[model samples]
Target: MAVLETPGAAGEPEIEVQIRGLMLDPVTNMPIVVLKEVGSDVVLPIWVGVFEANAIALELEKTETPRPMTHDLLRNLAKGLNATVRKVVVSDLRADTFFASIWMEQGGETVVIDARPSDAIALALRWDCPIYVSSKVMRHTRQNNAETAANVGADDLKRWLENLNEDDTGQYKM
Candidate 1:
């Protein structure tokens, strides 16, 4: 079973990870965003809702929306306030749910906001901020990865994405 640490979880230092990709879980038919440690096989899969998944996928695919989406609005608001999104940290995993904090810098002061991992991830992508996973979270996820063999080859993932229909992305609202 996978271990998940709650917020304020005391353990190892956080390890930086990059967004590997966004794909649908074959079994559950739910969208999952994959994160991978640099130069390592460690991977974390966070299942997300349909709407948030679409937001992340749009950013990943670099598809420009006709107007600002929620994430884009957040990015624009930050810019207007002269704040920068320093980074987003996937801080914990509790009860199979991941939590995150979005760190922002304004006027030399840093502010951290509690956010769902999916929203944090979407905003992070728009702001071009770095993404990190707490080491405890990673260690727990990695252990689970070993047992379930959750790693998917790049080719397989690419093929899965390629086969998606336009409507599969979900409809967008203004």
Candidate 2:
């Protein structure tokens, strides 16, 4: 299920988004996690480090490793502690960087942990939790990579998804 939050009385609602794909940025040669809104054409591409992208991609592709990865360990730890990850929020974009928070609940108490968007996204995928992007951040992206989704048809998106290859994940070994 998807979760959206308004930070305060005047805050904009967070919009739920899903991972579209992980691919290497042609110009930067860095990995990027592409996210798309569930019922809209809005898309956000967050450039991430190579290894973290691999972690997200592995979960997206349902590839199991012989040993638990870092995200796996964190998920298992939360389970061991009886903490449920309610949602992962990509809450802000400042100084050319994105920020996120992981909302968790345990023993009738709720907690929010500051996290990098990449790491929080990986854990969210593993836990089968929803991912949200603040409207504020969405506004910022509208001037950047948002056109990728705004003008594409469903068939185009499907073809793009179908063409994703292992090589597109960059040089990281999963």
Tens-place lDDT digits, model 1, residues 120-156: 9999999887788888787787676555443664445
Model 2, position 92: C-alpha lDDT score: 87
- List TM-scores for all candidates, in order: 0.78, 0.79
TM-score between model 2 and native: 0.79
**RMSD to true structure for each model, in Å:** 6.9, 5.2
Residue 119's C-alpha lDDT in candidate 1? 99
Count clashing residue pairs per candidate: 0, 0
User: For residues 1-174, what per-residue lDDT tens digits would candidate 2 score against the true structure?
Assistant: 233645511276888998766777767878888787878756677889988988988888789999999999999999999999998888888898999999999999988899999999999999999889887787777754435545664445434543555575443333
Q: Which ten contiguous residues of candidate 2 have the minimum total lDDT?
A: 1-10
Where does candidate 1 have its weakest 10-residue lDDT segment? 1-10
Candidate 1 residues lying further than 4 Å off, grouped into runs, are 1-12, 147-174
Best by TM-score: 2
